[model samples]
Target: MTMHNMKLKLTKVVAIVLLIVSHSVTANTGQPNILWLVIEDMSPLLPMYGDSTISTPNISQLANEGVVYNNAFSTSGVCAPSRAALATGLYPNSFGANNMRTSSNTAETGLPKYEAVPPVNTKMLSQLMREAGYYTTNNYKTDYQFKAPKTAWDENGIFAHWRNKPSNKPFFSIFNFTTTHESGLFEPYGIRKLEQRHYFSSDEKKIALLPNDHRIKTNEETTPVHIDKATRFPVPPYLPDTPTVQNDLWKVYNNLAETDKQIGAIVSALKNDGLLENTIIVFYSDHGGPMPRQKRLIYDSGLKVPLIIRFPKGYKAGTIDERLVSFVDFAPTTLAMAGISIPEYMHGHSFLDTSNERQYIYAAADRFDGFTDTIRAIRDNCYKYIRNYRPNEPYYLPVAYREKIPSMRELLRLQKDDALNKAQGQWFRKEKDDHELFNVCNDPHELSNLAYIENYKTKREEMGDALELWLADIKDDPLMKERQLIDKLWNGKTSQPTTEAPKIAVQNGKVTITSETKGAFISYRMKNDETSPHWQIYQKELPIKQGILEAIAHRPGYIESAPISLAIDAD
Candidate 1:
């Protein structure tokens, strides 16, 4: 056989092994079963991507045994919008998910006035998958638009039954693992920086896993003492290589290893349960690894993610597809895998079609809440264009972000002192970068701004126009009814500079403040701050339905709110 044929055969061989492992049939007979093993805060440091020291054996093994995607990207940097875009397969420009906080119980306050509620007038992947005949379930750790596709899942991940896995048709089970979530434990940073702990050995790792040892330090003036800081990590190119930063990155590496172990358990469970076959598994994180500027910002570090798919025997494997695919394309792609027709409302096209042109990928970030900044970007094969809606805001705000890592505070101090070098200082000094562009091929770190570059002007404008056209066609004006309230409740602070208006909220549930102009105003049309203009706004009494309210308040404004189920009766 020719070399090309040999390569194809080898790929198919790998696919066959997984098929055998999952007990799946080769053909597309009964629609491919969907299984998404999503890991939290992980980057593509897998062995397949050439990272040898990462302790991700199970994941690494999967990479070697399946297909790897080097160009898969998420829609937003933060968890909620990223997962929201993935679920809806629409850009944040279309789906308005400002940021979701761990304790976002402002039901009485309102939604973001400028942000769109997710599952925004579109069919979800799971909903489409169900019509195509698949049982969908989520295990744990969901960071998407909270109530999008309200009834998409047949079961929650923390509660799915494999035995009920429906022998007749296929199954789409999603397990979003959060073992690598940023727990306030990495190394500290600051004037008196800490040193990296060389703990490669298993025993050393155990001993080094102490809270004080990994303290991430900040300034005595601005930093708090009560903050936890043990998982110090290595500072990125933008920051100085202080001891605390080194320790912080080291902890992140350890977290990656720990997350890998958890994934192995889930895979082993699938194998042990005799449901390995007949399932097509796709492994990816919602976005990049959980690092500063990596999680909630709009750079490639935050948007780009690693995707690996393992299919059982009848197809190909051990292949590499380097097409520029975004989370927007995920829904249709998934529906295609489930043998369903793509919906017209979705702006995304399926990447499953090998002939699909992967010319560009689009991503955007917004001041999702009162916590973050507003930014949007578009990327083609070689260039990326960014438009910061709020240029006066600081890159890092007083979200739970500052509360999570200790070193972060120290870095901020250096930023003020101008001690950070050129690269690291850019984010600090960038108090007014309204429009920027970067030649991604030359500047993968996205440190340089090509927006002002004379030669790339045409290219930048073209991409910008494309982004605008896409948004316009989708009726994504960033203001509908519920979306407007969410924006005010979230981004009301910064957007004020442009709108020059006073933002009002619904307090004590009585006043309906109408503005003389179009700005942030609250109108309690619905009792529950409902979005529908037609719905009546009447607060009769608290419902009898209730759940065990475990007053688990968060540090505020970082993560998506944890869903609280109203119990039938009060405790």
Candidate 2:
């Protein structure tokens, strides 16, 4: 036997002596099933939020049946960074995952493909659910600024569902609707790739159509159901109210109506399965709207989103929650609702836990697509303060991805001709204020800057000092260039290394495993005659059973080790 094998044997010998204490290990088995219906690139534009631009009866129904959160915000204005905070229950900047995205689509930008190196012992929220014996599924986007671990899900594809798990097992499933994504604002709306079209039948399509919409060109013969074109929308002061911009508004609301239909389908499925009463449903958007100055900025139009949580049997039905909540609170909140202990390493506190209700929520903006800028924001219930680290950089970065939208193109054309009105011309300013303070409660459009007002100087200084303290506490070095940050993540190496494989030893009726890599979290699955195959977070040595055992090891940001398996008999 090799030296590694010898070490494994010794570990196994020690484990068998303590095997009697392992049989009682189990998690909270009676927790209710959880469901998250996540939509992308949307704001609170429904009837519940006082926006009459569109009527979302399905979402409105959920709002009537659940608790609606009016002050929910994303840490970042963009999706990938917000998702990283949601997945790990930690601030993205705390672990170098704060950039818009770390890999893929970086060739033109000349940035290396690197993953955000979080702490070694960190595990994704799905893996935590799996360890607690809950069936987990995501249908499925894993843009967490790092590659997701193999042990994170039992099913992670378009067809992944709660029904795939064994009967009576509690489940945590996430369904992401791309119909409301920013890409919906691109031209040729009928040809734009939408998630709803993938599953809708021709009959369902006809039911979703609106009368006389601009999305359909003069060329197409077929018309599907969509939102009404005659509905007049209240345009924000930052954009023009021209025919072109109004057309984009129509498209946005039309896409939202389609998103509501998709949400209804998932709720219907739960009811059909007779699981509606036993499941806790959550509905929310990933971030804010998808327009110029909204999708990637630190303004409330970019970071604020709609959040609704319906407990089993509508425990808090028809109530509006006015407390401030951030994306960082999501992971710990999920764990708290499921009866799992929240880890101390998490930066967020559970609103359900009631120990640490927050008085403020913080947000930040960094590099986006091909351009880079650094801005941090702090918000109370009534006021918002923003500090620009690079004050000389223009507020508009000319991002290639955002310019694809029709309204953005219109703004650029109007700017070139000097035909834009005062409100429409705010975004094209040559320079930006270094510090900005706004009473968002009074100025919903955030048009007026109160930073330099003599009467508000004390308030401005207080918010600025609070922001500085937050940055120091989170250990975020926004001044560090992106390239240097990448080097730090990779430890000055050209590439990251994969985690070392674990060594497993099976002796007598117990199995013990250890990895050569320190701080690697070990997860294993054992097949018994009664239960389906599912990964479990290994706490102690596992007792041998009648079926098979498989194990893998991983650390955050490092590639997972190859799974090792063993067969055991009843003897």
Candidate 3:
């Protein structure tokens, strides 16, 4: 028979075998149930992604039987933005969630001055699915741009899920499992642990199976909701190969394996409940694994995630659809699958509709590294373009850096050394790249930069224009109205904003600053100070200080403002 028919038959056979072997995943084909199993701080480390060192049996099994996108990426590099894009099918900046974290739009936080839009609008993918007559539920997690409003789900909680439903109703449920979050408190090794241990040999019988950062404290371990305390994470390659690193990586493998085990159990339970056959099960991660630079960044290791969609009946499983997929596309894709109309506001196209799927998947990143302001990247099937708006800013900002990850500190030290080496220098260097481009086909790791080369100028400009157009379409006029910076109040470790221009206000001897548009940061520095750098926002009880408070508000695509002057009476 034809190759296409043969592939379809093979898929059917596998589905049949799974039904027989596991005695689960059986149902009618006409109205299939939809299930989303989402993991946190994970990249595609499964065997399907070619990482032999770790055991991701369930995910690998899913990939083997489902369509896996080789070039999937998040629209934004950071968490809130990435999630915002994923849920809304729009770019993060367009949704006014351009920063790493955000305050929910409440009262003054909403509309007019600040877009009335909640960090995560209640009217999103899940809501759309529900409106399509599907019962929607969340597995208790909305760690996205903002809180998941009540209207977003019919039911949700840490222990309970909506998939625990009656078979008669077509259901759509999202399960966010937080077992791979890399946390500093989980470090069993204390501050200088990696420095103390060189290597930890494999001992499968060990108590923890993986020692983890050995830095994880019990109190911190209890918080399963946050990315930091979720699970024992794997250490990445950019760090030292110390015992700490080895143990950390091993723990990540162990934890991932356990997560997979749990996933199998959940699927098995679903089948037992007779939800398998008619169910379309999807497995993926929010961004990437919590291994060093993998999370909250635009690197492949950060943006690329494991994805598997399984349909025993109509989906034609074991078929690989390689068209580019971005997280932003998930919302529209879900609606399309549910037979719902695509919203005009969606910036992403559903991949399920060959006519609509993305020809070029877009990805970008703004400030996320605690106190750094960086705007970089674009990607399609072949090339990637990155423009660092703030090239002179510190590349290794302390805020986003993970202390428990062995690779980060190692890279930091290497950056200090004058000596140079090959295949290194990718981590912790002060000198920032102003612009970068790479042919991903030739360089999957994205180790090389082609942005400056004369030959690639045309391609870069094309991508740059495309990015601009997409961004312009998504800007939230209401949200962009309040132009103030998003920064930690007391910490010197506040991230940089996008631009310098916004209407300014200085009042009550205290500079009561507001933005012409809501920006990521509002930094202040003395006008005549020798250091041109800004002081991150640090104010609580304020009666303006005697020093001149020179301020600026910034966000992606927006320019920085001239300092708004503020003066306080001498104490």
Candidate 3, 170-225: lDDT as tens digits:
78887665556565224542332311111212221111112224434434344222
For every candidate in turn, the CA RMSD to the true structure comes to: 13.1, 8.9, 16.7
lDDT of 2 by residue, 1-571 (tens): 7999757744543343223112211134556788999999988888898887777888998899889999999999899999999999988988888788777558756987778877767878988888887889888778999888767888787667787876756899998888778888788765554434325242231122122243455233553446667778778888888888898888788788878887888787777677777777889988899977788887999999999987756577899988899999999888766667667688887776333458778988887877888889999998999998888778888888888899999999988999988777877778889999999999876878999999999999999999889889888887898888888877787877677887878777678888887667777776554464556667678776767777888876877889987777758
State candidate 1's TM-score.
0.69
Better candidate by TM-score, 1 or 3: 1
Backbone clashes, each candidate: 63, 7, 51
Q: Candidate 2 at residue 260, lDDT?
A: 88
How good is model 3 by TM-score?
0.67
* Model 1 per-residue lDDT tens digits across residues 1-571: 7999757744544443333434464233456667898876666766777665444788876776677888888877767777767777666556445444422534532432233444323555776665555766666445565443223555554445333555675678777655455552443432222121212232221112112233344554543333234544334587678876665666566556655765676666666555566667789987776666567777888888889987765345788888888888877777666656666667677666565667777776655344645666788877888877678876665555444575676677787787888887676664857788988888978998978878988988898898777668755553244446445335555331221122222334322223222322111222233233221111132233232211111111212223222213333
C-alpha-based local distance difference test score of model 3:
0.58
Model 3 stretches with alpha carbons more than 4 Å out: 1-30, 104-122, 163-167, 184-186, 189-243, 355-357, 417-423, 476-571
Model 2 residue 326 CA deviation (Å) reads 0.3
